[model samples]
Target: MPDTRQPVAARRTHCPYCALQCGTRISGTRADAVTVEPADFPVNRGRLCQKGWTAPGLLAAPDRLAAPLVRGRSGRLLTATWDSALQAAAEGLARVRDAHGADALAVFGGGGLTNEKAYLLGKFARLALGTSNIDYNGRFCMSSAAAAGNAAFGLDRGLPFPVTDLSRARTVLLAGANVAETMPPLMQHLHQARLVVVDPRRSATAHRAALHLQPAPGTDLALALGMLHVVITEGRLDTAYIGRRTTGFEALAGRAAGWWPERTEAVTGVPAADLRTAVDLLTQSGDCYVLTGRGVEQHRQGTATAAAFINLALALGLPGTPSGGYGCLTGQGNGQGGREHGQKSDQLPGYRSLSDPADRAHVARVWRVPVGRLPGPGLRAYELLDALGEEQGPRALLVMGSNPVVSAPHAARITARLAALDFLVVADFVPSDTARLADVVLPVTQWAEEEGTMTNLEGRVLRRRALLDPPPPVRSDLHVLHGIAVRLGEPPEHYPTEPRKVFEELAAASEGGRADYSGITYDRLDAGESLFWPCPATPDPHPGTPRLFLDRFAHPDGRARFADVEHDGPAEDTGAAYPVHATTGRVLTHYQSGAQTRRVPELAAVAPEAFVEVHPDTAARSGLADGDLARVVSARGGMTARVRLDPTLRPDTVFVPFHFSGDGRANLFTHPALDPLSGMPEFKVSAVRLEPLPE
Candidate 1:
């Protein structure tokens, strides 16, 4: 807990939205009466987006949950005392567990949770509930990139180098990332570099690019393969670096040989000349960076698409160099840290594999639990949701800090699944769409009312400071977890409510693993140390690793591996009935799910409702005009939104922001077909048709 005696004015903290985690300072004594100003921080450099500026609105949101609520006999959620709510929740979960065994209880977490809360939630699920079904929303965000990174580099960090290092690049190739709208402050680092953007629509980021390749949706993998093919045939490969620093070059080279530029252009709808130009821009400059975002990564072949781009970077000797590399621009506040600790189904704290004997032993010893007591790996996020209340599946679900009703792909199905659950518990600050359906809703502290750490997109571990106390009836997630664990018969000492103590246990648990954080202390962070991960405990004062793979990779042989990846298009194909491609993404004013951003008055005014972005020609062809209510219907489902015409979009593609709920919810049109390697759903591309709704 934060010291009450500490001054309440000018307390520094980080934004609650996005992985950039812009530094901010609050200048008031309470949540309802505070002002936010940008603070000097390396990542954002004192700048903030609209979401960051309006983050304080969440602390005093009109819909903020200040009391516990439990469903009564009539299925209406009524206000309940803390004791009654806890007991009801415990009994409900225990009832399901007793009837269907431990695996029948599942846990779902969020990427926005503080490191302390994320670690404890995983521990609580494994040790207290003895359940194997656990996963987080990050599976929908960057799991594909993580999978590709681990396969290629033997490690997975959003960016192995600091975000500032991007400023030194001469050319930058951005694939399916609209950073200008998604993360505005990042544009500052790319101002000096020539931008080459690839997308189906001309996004804010594309508007500023030196070149934009408007490929057909889900054809990003084909584009990348074509670029690699161009690089290989043109004899532009850095043979020396390839031979010295990586393996599997022969297999990758053989694969690339088949994806000639003309053949790729035929499949991707990108011109052969543009494919050659993209390859030239990437390889001609010795200092360049390749970055991918959700556009290319939310597909059935997402991992392969990510790997194809990595293969391009590796062949050009970009990664492991000072001014060049391949990295993923993570989406959430703690997306990097959330996955590092044990929130994923198959991972333990410190990114250790759950199936590895030695890794399991190390974490079990730190947790003070017998190694065999820890349950085995369980279902991924989509699978878990799909299995709700099914035979031999999870009968009860506990969701903390995430709203899957509005965020998950094929969301109508997910909502139905939640409704089918025997018991549901949701911990959130506001009554989000998912929380509205929970059997028990626990009011938990928000970013301004909690103290912990978050790892940013650069792999930089940052301190998240609390500026004000939570409302009297509200509790921190740590406390909620602690209370539930106690009810589950776990000793009080096992689940500490103090963030620092939980971090101490986390550090010890992560000591020898890949994402080691043993040497990082709150004192060190307070002392202004700019620490990155893999900071091991040492007798000598060790500078945290700001950059990785400078000399060697994390693999046993000290060399990166090149995956023999090839292009596999989207799971769904276009036809006469559903000819247009529909893709989903973020808007400048909204963050994930619109749970927090949609509640802000100022933000709501700027972008109050979701609208579809279609080319004028496409709209005209469909007999639709700007501001016309239209239904984008896919085979799975449909969502209705106002049409907004933009000539910059590809004539066959339309864009929708995924933040809105109700009729405007974009995920309704998305598919649950997942990337086999990463379990990431196909949120970006789907085949659909537009129908104008009668006014």
Candidate 2:
């Protein structure tokens, strides 16, 4: 008889849900039901969301792809052996490279990957495949904010400080972020600050705020400019700090001169009085913080909006101060780290620009390849996909850890272009919407069965420990990527077998660059110590930086540049055919696309169906009631979902959470127009028509 005293089954591990990256302790095995409990980590302090607690159920879900799958002659997926799958992938990639050159293949990565896996994927794409047409889902998530921050402050680390620091702030201006729903635990800190939420609708975060300014979508820049105008006119600006620590004050002040409250009020729909009050509160507070999220960054004017927001922070001397600054609230779990490690179209590891000769030389030395072997930055995501259908299109693609069919913009066009590829390979734990379209799908270990690090919104790099063994026939993503690189004849120096060694090499590649991580190692991380990046060599014994730009800015002049920005409308405006401004976002019950959370029965039960949120007045006008099926159509695409009249939403606006699949792909209706500077698609505001579905 089996020992009854022993645990009934094998131990489980943490959930691979959101950027919250909550620690979960799993105990049980496939023979029995698995149990998951929150671990007492400093980040969450044993707090677990419904998604985290129910994550283990997904491991044994019936629909999980337990083995390799490959498309057959009939265009349907068939089970295949690991060797056969890998060989096919290698041959297909090699054929594409030989026939069409390296640029003919594109690789798409995800923000959910382990740092080791992310690093190796970039290495494989550039070194092994010799392709520059590489980008990631992060291109949609945080690239615009990063571009804005890099241009204005010379650095972008999301929050640039810990989330815990928010509790120390006297006032917090949450512009466009919906933290209460996307990251509920973070709301605990917001309660301490006098919260001010700015959005087109009274979102949950806005309802909780002391002041909620409901401006029209895409008019955030005007609201920010107006606030700056009030602050400056009232002599509330931090003149001493601006005189010493910042540049471009004269140009910025001149730009704000024309954006008086009355003028901005007419443009943004925010009351002039409210704008003045917001400015007064911001200036009176000892410590104030300004934060922006996807609502502001996923737009054509994203970079400019971010710059304008930063200008307000700079005008008040908030940045580089304790518990006060301008922060971009990144969405993905590894969104901060993913961009920092050269996953973007125009960057190298260490957040270095590909055009920088010294950065190129340093990374080339680390990879042990000639500087010429590393191509300059490639096209962004939308451009990469668009190139797939062009005469000089990519013949093959290797996608890892992302579901672009559901997540990417212009879904119909992107799907058609993907189908045109000569070869497609996807490496993931489950059969995602994108994987289902691949020529070959390789099974990989999930978060609970993997070991690595993930940097959170606050730039805090924390360890993600593997607590259980992966299922049979499954391997780590890093291992799978390394094997592919080796099979493709990458240089021996770049063919490191160990994940830790690869991370060390990645750290070395980041040395003396903007997102510097040279001073860190796997050893230090394994010791339960964590810190932010730019951890350069120091004389003391500390490991990494927790807060950046405390005494000096990263710019050569040690001064932050204030961007003079003007308001711009969204790409698509609400009109007769498309009468509602459709917005997409996350929900408390689910994470992006619901690839993991949907597997959990409990989490699925909590949010079983997709629904479009419309105001009661609009729903009535459209002859629809709550729970009624509503057909929503935009210029790009259309979908049908159950309707829920939200009192908080403005009459002309609709909201949809981007967690469902099939016809419920919210991105299907999103506009593909991108920010000129960052190439981030505008997912927040799309013109859409809502009508009651036929009975």
Candidate 3:
């Protein structure tokens, strides 16, 4: 009866979920329920996670906003035509700009957007709106690693090489990444390597590791320096590599000498014997990789921790090798590409700093604007939100593809400040919690219904093709942004209608810059050839690049710099009132903020509610039984959630997944203090206490 004999057309694309960017095939038409199947692409071969497999269900969700909506005078949201919606949004922004200058308005973006959208948003913020108060959700995700990598190596791609290369490695040191829960398929490759996982808790990945180094929450730098001390003092350092391929070795080694294992053990919970074993594994491996994640990057010493990781890698001659290097495991699908395309406040396209005159001139020319019009880097996310309710606060904001109320630090404060804004606009497929506060909400197309490109965790640029037509009245993000720019009197040539043309302009802006992408084109990507970035000016038609820096470094001296890092505690330390150290992270079942995944019935059925993970001892002490509601309280806020006693967690620590909101908003309790250099909030560690919720 349903035409079962008809062959469904196959639409090839990348998963819209995590940074894994596994290939997927959309089977069936928009009229019928579509099914997502794993494609046999090089990245994941044929593996699909629960999120990826059910990604298409989001398209048909009943709650999806199919038409633009405006908050009427009655304080109720009602459907409005596109023209009316755009006009209202433009007038509000223009009024704010006229009254308080452009700096009084702000724009926030996210890593989930395509490169075209990211570039246009940055362009609109700087050129159309004439504002320097532009930032993004990346301020919470990758700014720290980006800052450290730029300081040390002049580049910051998540993996500077392909993730599959890890299979060839003999030793893989996972400094703070929980690969088993975040990207489970990656464990298949890590299985062969001598795994070394470092974290305060014995995470799932750490439990499977050859060695687990449980350090105090903020003492990762100390343990890293201590390991480096052993390597240098015991003559295990690769002297030839140090002499020929790196600078600042003496300074780094001198800093390490003061961090002896015995001293480090006193600060960190890890013992000296375990530290020796971890270093020995690194020294003996034919090929080794040093990896860091948000655990190491979301702290006061974030940049220092990243630098220490790079120092250890350079000391071992890891960079520029196929399976050997220092990798920062990025969290978002477009985290790698987002930073390269000027989404960051301090950067331009191609990861060029705005302070550089040549970089400034290059971008100014690309955007056809005077260099003077392009203001310098703006405030980071946390700082921007903190400025929201002040007398000199940003009065208007444009939020694209992010739900910061749940994701940003200090949830209650951010929500209160955002409510005070004179105007707020949000462009998204769904009316997220943050969107609910918006004066204007624009309906944008979802990933499976849009055509663009995304760079994965490994820096592999791949095509994301549209499988279904957008619902009537909904439009692509590019279309919405372009309309707004045109309405604001931007030249027609400056605002292109097609996404491909915009991407080409973005690529041209990046040409000859640090993160060179001159070689990438829509034509090549459509031909099913994936390539790592810094793809040369001359095109290589054969599947782009699988690895980078095989022969050279991006630094001017052709060597990576090693930075000296010391021990520093978290922004908020555990104390008598808040004795437990609570960390926030993602669960395999839910993606960031539980936006689209939570809408899927099957996925929601499996993981229907949020829960706090506590050690059995902690549960017993707090009188919290398994599945009982427990109140997690901090100095700033508190929330009630079901409790699960996890054996893997340490007795002194607890874990909370940052996907739920409202009464269970984990970010409400997260400290707002940020790493000065990276601007990343301390999401991984905070001070809190737990109690059994009374019936």
Best by lDDT: 1
lDDT for each candidate structure: 0.91, 0.82, 0.84
How many collisions between residues are there in candidate 2? 2
Question: Please, what are the lDDT tens digits per residue for candidate 1 over residues 98-168?
Answer: 89899999999999999999999999999889999999999999999999999889999999999999988
Q: By lDDT, rank the candidates, best first.
A: 1, 3, 2
Looking at model 1, which ten-residue stretch has the lowest summed lDDT? 1-10
Candidate 3 lDDT, 637-665, residue by residue in tens? 98778899888787888888898878787
Q: For model 3, which pairs clash?
A: 531-545
lDDT of 2 at 418: 87
Maximum-TM-score candidate = 1
* Predicted candidate 2 versus true structure: per-residue lDDT over 454-546, tens digit per residue: 777777766776645677778777767767776787655566656678778877888888877777777777665676787875667456777
| TM-score, candidate number 1 | 0.98
675 in model 2: Cα distance from truth in Å?
A: 0.3
